[model samples]
Target: MELRLTLSLTAALLLPGLAIAADAHADTAPAASRQAELPAWEQLSAEQRELLISPLRDRWNAQPQERARMLEHAKRWKALPPEARERARKGVHRFEQMDPEQRRIARAIFAATRDMSPEQREQFRKDWARMSPAQRQEWLRKHPAPEGGRGR
Candidate 1:
């Protein structure tokens, strides 16, 4: 569930460049450059489109119970305003930039308080920031991270 929350948070900006980069024989450039220059959906071939959507498809198949929630998330993402979508894309990019440990803490915190109001989340973050390392660890221990939300 935690993993689902973290992933759903980014569904608005979930362009699978990996699908493009996976074309080993065709893409002559280095993998990094290929990923950097991902083609638009219409530009890609049928295979590329399949590869792009495969992860989401596989995840959907694997988690039957979460299908309704996941579908709702996609609908909500589509319903967001253009400016709001851009902000979400930027937020995902910022989240991607954090170090591994920071990412772990972020995912954990996000999973813990995703249902809170904005003001409440801000207050929670302030309280979290005030905790000592040991206290933070204790807090984490008490509210352990879910299996797949470990910043993998």
Candidate 2:
């Protein structure tokens, strides 16, 4: 709902006290400087460089604003404590392994709950916690992931 779909996972990596401060002006001088010092394609690790390759080899330019946000997010990720980093890595890995349909369902669920009031959210949590494992499984089976997968 807040349009943080791209970096929500990255933001979740932060502990409450250490969450990166939101910047109203993303094109600030420090961000510009960081972008200027971004590593060249050849300088990145194989996995990092691979992210730049388009499946169709389409020509594109990375927007400076987007690049700055990425670098900022990376800096925050690197600064996380080892335990936090490991937890974040496991979460990201799990998300990556989800099928398209599962991902679509997850996104929908996220959107649906994103703005819930604290009391409503707490009640939902309480209801979930009250469910038995078998009940949870049955509920999931009844509400399967979207069949059509993601939409354009």
The residue ranges of model 2 lying beyond 4 angstroms of the native Cα positions read 1-61, 111-124, 127-152
- TM-score of the candidate numbered 1? 0.60
- Pairs that collide in candidate 1 are none
What alpha-carbon RMSD in Å does predicted model 1 have with respect to the real structure?
Answer: 6.2
lDDT of 2: 0.49
lDDT of model 1 at residue 62?
95
lDDT per residue as tens, model 2, 77-105:
78878887776665455546666644654
Off by over 4 Å in 1: 1-40, 90-100, 150-152
What tens-digit string does per-residue lDDT give for candidate 1 at 66-149?
A: 688668767777788888777667656666666766556556666677667778766876777688889988987887655676
Against the true structure, what is each candidate's TM-score?
0.60, 0.38
Q: lDDT per model, in order?
A: 0.62, 0.49
CA error at residue 118 for candidate 2, angstroms: 9.5
